[model samples]
Each structure stands twice: as C-alpha cells, then as structure tokens.
Target: MDMVSPHTKNTTELRDRKRTGEILMGHGYKRGAAKLIGVLVALVGFGLVHGRPVDATDKVRIALSVRNVVFLPFYYAKDRKIYHKHGLDVEIIQMRSDLQLAGVVSGEIDYTPAIGPATLGAANSMPVKAVAVLYNAPLFSLVTPASVSSLEDLEGKRVAVSRIGSDSHRFGSLMLENGGADSKKVTFIQTGSTTVSLASLQQGAVAAAVLSPPFTGIMAEKGFKVLGRSRSLVESPWLGLVTSKQKLERQPEEVKNMLLSMRDVITAIQRDKADVISYIEKNFKVSKANATESYDEIAGVIVDAMFMRDDQIKKYLEGTHARGETSKLLAPEDLFDFSLVRGLK
Candidate 1:
C-alpha cells in the first residue's frame, strides 16, 4: 500500500529528470519504477487537469514574427495541425523582434521564421540560419492619409516608424530611397504599433506610417492610401525561421518537416482564404476588403516553388557584402538553409 510522490521540477524538464531517474534506478536505487511512474503521471496530470503544455517535448515553442499576413502560414500550420503532424509540440510565440539571440543562445525557444530584425541579426553574425520562406515578399507597407498621393508628398511631412533602429525605420528609409527623396524631407516619427501608427496617421501626428498586413489593410479601408509597399519592389529581400545551426546539423529531417508544414500552410492560405480570414480579422481587426488584399498579396508571392526567390537572396547578399556586413559576421554560412522548401517545385 506504499505510494510514491512526484518530483519537484515542471513537466517540460521531466524528460531530463526521468533519464536521470532511470540511471539511478539501474543501479538498484530506491526511487524505482514507482518514481518513474509518478513522474509520468505528474506530466499527464498537469497537462490533462490544467491544460498546460502540449506535447511530450512540452511545447515546440516557436516564436512567430508578429501577427500579420506574413504569418498566415504559421497561423494555418498551428491551426491545421501541420506542425503537430510533423511531430512537434508547436506553441506560437507572438513577437516583433525575432533577433532574440540571448534566448536562442540559452535554449529558450526551438525556432523562429525570418523577420527583418532576424535578417539584421544574420548580417551581424548572430548564429542564426534561415530555414524557409513563409511569403516571398516584404510583407510590409507605408500607410498615409488620402491627402498624400506620392512619396514626394511625404517630404517635409511627418512619417511614423516603429523606432530609429527597427525594421519599420529601415522600411521607411527604403521608401525614401525608392522615391528619390532627401533623407531629411520626411520626419520619420517614432510612434509605435500598427494601431498607434494608424492613429498617428489619422490624427495628423504623422502624414505616413510604415506597417504590415491587416494594419495597412485596416487603415487603407479607412481612407489611408498605401504610399509604398515592400512587396511592390521587384524582389523580396527578407529572411524567416532563422534557426540555430546546431538544430540544422543534428535534426535536418525535423527541419524539413517544419518547412513542409509551413509550405502546406501556404497551400491552405491559397486554397482556403476565408477559413483563415476570421482569425486574421479577429486578431488584426482587418476589414474583409483589407483581408482580401492581404491574402492576395501573400498568395501572389508564393511561387510554384515554395522557397524564396534565389535571385532576391543573391541581391540581398550582394547588398550586405557591399556594406561589408557578411564577412564581419560569424558563421556566415549558417545564416540561411535552403535545402527543404527549395526542392518543393
């Protein structure tokens, strides 16, 4: 009638404890099969009773690059069980800065798709590897009031970017370069968030604001015109899912399955736009018209081959080289991985 008590550590770390327990028990330790069974029960009990972590691995712990059109693939993959189908636990983390090297270095997350910040991290040598492409475009746009017709109008006008060093800032800079405007012409204000930026645009705080997906779509529906969109460029020069090189070398099939899940989600985005739009609207507050625009924008960029356009990568690389960023970067070869989605044709 003797009962065993559970261990102190959480279920996610239980695997390690279980392994250690096995080692101890192998040498005739008292914390016997009963202890192992107790730990198993504890994991099941916490998950079943409290609805905590998902898989035996606890959670896939993926950092999603903000909630936007670019993330449609992940939204579908998580909703459609594609990540799960690939034997993953799959908890989608919503974050803007995907460059988070400290966490990735310390093993806090399993993976993340490329966002602009992560691309910067690669250019700076952050030990990240681009795994696959979610959408093959910039997935961002600069929104302006109806009064502003072109980038020239933006000159001497207040424009909003997320921050001075952020991707939105870079995007605004690119917009200026495209339009042949002087750098000092636009104010490049630092109001944050798509909603806040939209508000700033509406309130005359900023004549224009750079934002993404449903955000741009929402403001555009409300009479804000898209002054410039990153997708409008001839090529997409971005990265996603910048995984650690260690993961790429040790579990390449797992990486392949992850990319496969992402591609399958893209297929769904093209085929079943409406089914996913509800989430888009609920999360992004995007209007149906704007949702349509965002969805179309996403689908148009997903070529027959599921990978990013190679020419685009080459151009981006060349630009980085011109800036002398790649050589200065550590483990430059780990910056990208093209084996999975590249063969999807």
Candidate 2:
C-alpha cells in the first residue's frame, strides 16, 4: 500500500473525530465532557462556516410579595409551561415587597409583580418601572369578628394589617375612608401577613383585619363578618408587573416574551374559570369553596392587557400621595412603560 501524505492523514483524522462525535451523540451522550469534546471536534472540522454555536436559554428570576391568588396568572404560567413555551426559564421567588424593589433595581431580580406602595417606589427614581397592571382593583377586605356588624363598629377598635405602608394598610385606610369612618381612630397593628393578621383577629388581639382571599374566605367561613371590600373603595391599579428600565431597553425581547406569557395567562383566567379556581386551590392551599369565592372577587378585575390608563395611573399616584408614601406626583408615563403591552394581543 502507498504511504498516505501528511495532509491526507490530517483529513482522515478529522473525519474519524467527526464519526466518533456522531456515534457518541447517537448513543445519547449529549452532556458532560463527552458532549463538549464532540462539539469542539465538530467545530474544528466544519470551521466557522457551520454558523454560530447555539446559545443557552435565558433564565429570568421574578419576585412576588406573597403567595396569593392575586398572582394566579404567574402561577398558572409556571405550572402550565407558558414560560417554557416562550423559551424562558423562569424562577419565582417569594420576597417582601420592600426587598423586591432593591432586587429589581440592582438587577438581582428581573421582574416583580408588586402592590401599589411597592410599585410607587419607581416614582422615587428607583430603576424599576411598572410595565403592566395585574389587578385593577384591590383584593383586600376588612374582616371583623361576628360582634362587629359594619366598618362603623371598628372606629375605636384595633385592626391588623401586613404593615403600616403596605397594601393591606392602604386598603384598610381606603375602606375606612369610604365607609365614612375615621381611619385615625382605628389603630392598625402590623401582623406581617394576612395569615398573621387573621391569627391576630382570632386571638382577640385585633377587632378586625385587612385580609385578602383565601384568608378572607376562611374568616367568613369561620363566622367573621366581611365588613367591606377594598374594590368598592379603591379602583387604582392594585398590583402590576415591574421591571428595570434598563432591562426594558436592553432586553426588549425577554420583556416582550414575559408580557406575552402574562397575556396568555390573563386570557386563560378569563376563559377557564374552573382551571383558575383549581390553580388557586392548589397554589394557595385553600378549599375549593374558598378558591371559588376568591376567584369571584377578582375575576372581573383581572386585566388581559397590562396597560394602565392615564386616569388609573393618576388615581394610583393620588392614592400614594394621600397615604403620604410619596409627595411627588408622577404622571402615568413617568411610572409605567405601556409600549411592551401595546404589542401583545
């Protein structure tokens, strides 16, 4: 046999490497050092003409204030693989609203679905901006012991809220104001969460508590009086998705994918009432009856598009100012970016 030339020998070696890589891949070895080496061999053999290497899927971290039904859409999106369908790997973290702001601004967290007070932090020049409204009306209700018949009865009594500057407190104050009761006369004790607020109410530490569903439903089931709901008192954007403006500008596609996922979630909420209730029952750890009650309270107000109208943002800003949370009144354009939602169907 004739001796093979050096060039032919090199070509034969590359072909052998390519065949080995294909065999390894065919044997279901698509990970670890073997996969890396296979990819390298293929790259060197094919040269740059084979096109660029495949990029890893993007991962997004989202924070939520609490595990409540208000964020049903997000829960649904995760459980139903909607985020995966959008080509994103989403991680949901339960964090306090105060902490979430810092997370978003520092780029530690990519997105947050926050309440009014938390979202208002954007007005203070925080890097985050509210991109979409999740809940148009408040989800909280002033629940009291059976002895108290109405909001008027709780004038001199102590009420429990999540915190002083929290959404629960805002809803409680708004309810008191709408009920024509003096909010100042009613002391708001901070219980840290709706569950703790309920505990406080049950233990007689508080006469009433600003509890959102399914806690509110539990209270009602236990004979607590539903004194009033925040929906009647407040119509501002109670909850919404917030992200850094930098992310909005630099990662427009990711932001758009997130909003698209949300849009689908909202549509699911509207079209499939039973599925939403089931999700609420599973995620919130509540009874089906409680889930249904919670669903009924928010179904009509769940927004398909995250767009906040001029009046809605103005009302939110006014409410924020009224609570003394922020003195500066920012316009809708200043606090929100409606461009992302505009493209969503």
Candidate 3:
C-alpha cells in the first residue's frame, strides 16, 4: 500500500530465503544433504535404483525331460553363449519327464522343453503353457532285436518304455499302430529311464524299446533293427519352450529374451549344420556319422520360427487325446501364448 514495488518485494523475499538456508547450513544441514546425496550415489552404483538391479544377467533354469538331439537348440544356445548374449545365464537341468511339469508349476524350474507334458498340464488346469515349439515331429524309433522283423512280431513280447504313461510309451504305441500292429497287445514295461530302457533292449530284457537320439543311433549301430520311426507316422509339436503362466505374466521381458536367444540358436543351427553336429558328437559322445544322423533327424523338424501354426497346434491337441482320453480341454489360445514370439519378429 505504501508504494511497495513488486521487484523490491521479490528481492527481499529471496534474500530472506538465502539467509535462512545459510543459518540452517551452520546448524549441520549441509552435511546432512551431502550424506543423502552420497547414499543415493552408492545405491545407484550398486544397481539398486528403483528397486531393481540394472543390466543384471537373469539366471534361468530350463528343465529337460531327457537329453536328446531334439533338444539341440538349447544345447547350442548354451555352447555358443547365445543365452549370455541375451542377458541370460541358462542352466540346462536334466530331469525325469514325469517331474518336469510339476517342477515348473512349483517354481523349482523356470521352463521345460517337454512339450507333451506342458500341454497336458495346461489341459488339466496346471498353471503352465507351451509358449513356443521347437521340433514338431515325434523323434522316437521303435528299436527291436534282429529276430523281430515287424511290429506284429512285437506282440506277446515285453517292450521297454521309460514309464507307463510316458511319451515313449505313447509314441511307441503310435509307431506300432502305424506299422499295422496292435499297440494294446504288447506289454509296456516301465524301465525308469530311456538310458535304462536302452540297456534293457540291449540285455534282452525287452524285445523292443522306444529310443530317441543319440540312443536311436546307438541302438542302430549295435545291429538293433528300427521297426518303425515315429516321425514318419506322427507329426506334432515335440520339443517346446514352456513356462509357468506366472512367469509369462510377471516377467514377460525375461521370457521374450529367452525365446529370442532360442530363436537365434535355431537360426544358427540351421545355418551351420556342422557346428551342431560337432556339438552332438562332442556332447553325446557319439560317432561323427551317428551325430550326423541325429542332426539330420532333428534339423528337419526344427521349427523355422518360435510360434506354432494353427495346424501344428491342432495336431498337438489331437495327439494329446490320441489314446481316447478326455480332460477339460482348453482352447488353443488358452493353452498357448505366442504373442511374445510374434512380437519379437
């Protein structure tokens, strides 16, 4: 009111604020501010900013039902450090097929390559899904002794399978049926594992066994006859990248990165067959020729992309119910989520 100009009033207020700051500094406010800044800097240095580690490599555990050439993409990714390239430290754990899906659901395993188990788990309301498929063909062979000339000869004889309700038994039955024999007539003995099943076939414990590579090649080399190869008759999504729904929903970026690494590994394997063959030979301890055979079988079936086609999904769904078994069948969209793989492309 007494001609107090706006500029003069603002300058007076600024000076008052500055004087207050100086007084507080004299009372140790400056040291407190400096300590706070130091703490923030330390947190940033330790990658604890915003409650997450920055640029940290994700440690992922992928469960393998059993080691076979169909699972070569995972092995190739680890050997070539492709997973590391995508900021992943992948540990390939070998576990029994029966336990893999349960492990995935229980959070003990992050992902599993056992596509059949993954699909079945989803149909039965397990908290899992098959995100991507790698091999879309059944890669098993019904191996028998020289005396058994045909699938019919397998009748009344004990055939070896890793387990009664295992993929080996299912696919082995399909192989027999495709060969014009009755799968029900043959007895499927649980041998605990494929390695043991192979041993059983070798030791004359079982007349025939379902074998995947390099075991298939191993048996062939020992003069065991391959009565039929499952791939020729059955074609469904075999090896796949499956994960719990929680992981897919909560940590999509991690899932995408893992799939990207796998997609790149598939490309590399397709581009350089020799590299994968060499890996098979060195890792599985098979002959170069046997490795090449295994590579040929696996290479032919490796999906060109991570996402499954409608027909492939249909084939997979149909294959799941091949034994005329029924369950609360989930829709394809509910059972599979390829959006992440689709987004990557």
Candidate 4:
C-alpha cells in the first residue's frame, strides 16, 4: 500500500471535517458539534445532501473490547488504509465486551473483534456468528504485586478484572483454578477496563489482576510479577471477528472486502515488525522497549487466516463451561460461520 504523507493525511482529515461541518450547518446544526454529529449520522448510513456525489465506499463500524494490542489487525488496517484500499470506510469503535454484541445485533455496529467466550454466549442467544479467529490463544496474564509471588497467595485477597463474564474474568478464574486455588475464595472486582484494573492493583485495592498485553507489560515494568499466563491454562480461540447472519446474507461482498482488508493487515504487521512496533509505541504511549515487548508477546498468536478449527471452538466452549459461565455445549457450527472467508488466501 502506498503511504500518505503526514501533511497530506492531515489536510484530508481537515477537509473531511470541513465537509461534515458544512453538511451539518446546512441541516441547521450549529458549527461547534456539527462535525461530530455529522460523522455519526454518516456512520449510520444517513444520506447528507451537499449537492455532491455520495461516497462510493461502504462505511462499516466495528467495535473493539478495548484499545489493546490484541486487536492490532483492525488498528493496522485502519491506520494503513488497508480497509480503504479494499473499498471500505471503516470506523473503529471501542467499548466494553458485554455491549459489543448488542451493537452488532442492533445494526449499530457492523463487526466486532470480541473475545471467544462472550461471543459464544452472544451467538447462542442471537443470529451473530464468529467469522474469523484473530488470536487463537488467550492474550492475558495473571499479574500480581511483587510481594505476592504465587497464585496461592491471592487466596482471600481481591483480584480485579475488566468486568464479570469478560475475558479477563474468565482468565483470572481459570488461572486460579489451574493453580488449585478455589476461585470462590478470591474476590473478583470489576474495574471496567484493563487500564483501570492495573490502577486498582497499583492502589493496592486488589492483590492481583488479569491484564493483557501493553498493560501487562506496563505492570511488569512497574515491578509486578506474572503469576501465570492464560495461554498456559487454556488453548481455545481467544479473539475473533463477529457479525450478524443478516450482514453475511445482505452484504456478502462487503464482508469479503473487510476480510480481505484484515488479511492485508495481518500480512503487513507480520512483514513489517518495525512499523508495527512504532504504531504500538505511538498509539499505546509506551516506550520502545515496552512496545516491542508487547508486540513480541502477542505476535506469535495472530493468525493470517480467519478460520478457527472445530476443536478450538469446542475447547473454548468447554473451558467456558468448566468456569461455570454456561452449561450448554455448542458445536463449532453453532458459534461460527467459517464459510465467509473459506476461499480467501
């Protein structure tokens, strides 16, 4: 992909903002917040009449669990204009894991690169389907203060997670269970996000926390010790792309384009480690060492293709059941639609 000069990119963004403002002003919206509202309105497919031809590129809104390295493929796709190259105007939205499914089901968000456990639960209740596995292994670590050397030491102490029933919660519980500590003996605190969970740990409000890359590296750099990693406890599909079945049926070409863009992103990141590292450092606001550490920790897990094995999905479901989150056994077909990217290389 050809790179756009920083000046050119900034100019383009300013022009787009100006256009949005003009459209909103014509629609009787004041200038101050019109640009923001105009962007939102355009994202939801509302036509704005500016006496100019409508944009031919399809707009897609995708949700992320948080702004972390685990979703780097989507980030790289947007940053490098891979999505645009594939004829998509992708808007990335970050939100809590629990709310992402609702956005997809309500048609407010077009795709979600959500956690496997939560995605399975959403699939069981709705027409949403997992179309791609971005990371086949859990990207979280059971981190504890330096004084608390082992998982056993966390007994009767508070542990923090992004939220209950989130990937962090499941990973923390599994880490405790694998260490022979009854998770019931530990108090799980919901910290809203990994950044906050780390803050809770720093404040000594929680003895330990389950954190993913970048934040995990940040905590470790602050003198915390990693008691365990989630990948060691479970081998399931960790993160994947999800969309409604209606989307697959109604916009097959667009879905294919999105997947193709994702493929390009994976390829780009894999082939250009320095660029990805720079992106990580700039976006996460971490040092070069921290950024490289985060990328190294997660690079091995990102897959080039979108498909997840049947056994992998089954193992994820089984793990979720073992954690007592859900009792129903869902087959691979019940949770995912592998057919979407079947022919994509």
lDDT of 2 by residue, 1-345 (tens): 001111111011212435534533543433222122234333334541121111244357777665566667777888889988888788776656666665565444578777464445655555557888878887788888888867888888899888887777877888988888899899988877666776788999999888777778888899989888888766777667887766787778888888888888788788889988887777677889999988888786777667867887788787677667786777777778888798775
Off by over 4 Å in 1: 1-55, 309-311, 321-334, 342-345
**lDDT for each of the candidates?**
0.59, 0.70, 0.72, 0.69
RMSD (Cα, Å) of model 1: 12.0
Per-residue lDDT tens digits for candidate 3, residues 1-345, read 000111111111212435534533543433111123234334434643221111364357776654555677887788799999988987776555666665565444578877777666666666677888888787888999988888999888899887777777888888888888888899999877676787788899889988787778887899989889888886677778888776787778888998899889989988998878888887777899999999999887888877678776876676566555437555677678888988896
TM-score of each: 0.75, 0.81, 0.81, 0.81
Span of 10 residues, lowest total lDDT, candidate 2: 1-10
- Cα lDDT over the full model 1: 0.59
Root-mean-square deviation of every model: 12.0, 16.6, 20.6, 7.8
lDDT of 1 at 258: 76
> How many pairs of residues collide in each model?
7, 0, 0, 0
Q: The CA-based lDDT of model 3 is what?
A: 0.72
Q: Write the per-residue lDDT of candidate 4 for residues 18-62, one digit (tens) a residue.
A: 564564455454443222322433433432212111146435777
Task: Kindly report which residue pairs in candidate 3 clash with one another.
Answer: none
* Candidate 1 lDDT by residue in tens digits, 156-243: 8788876666667765677777877665777877654555676777888877888876677767778778878777764653535666
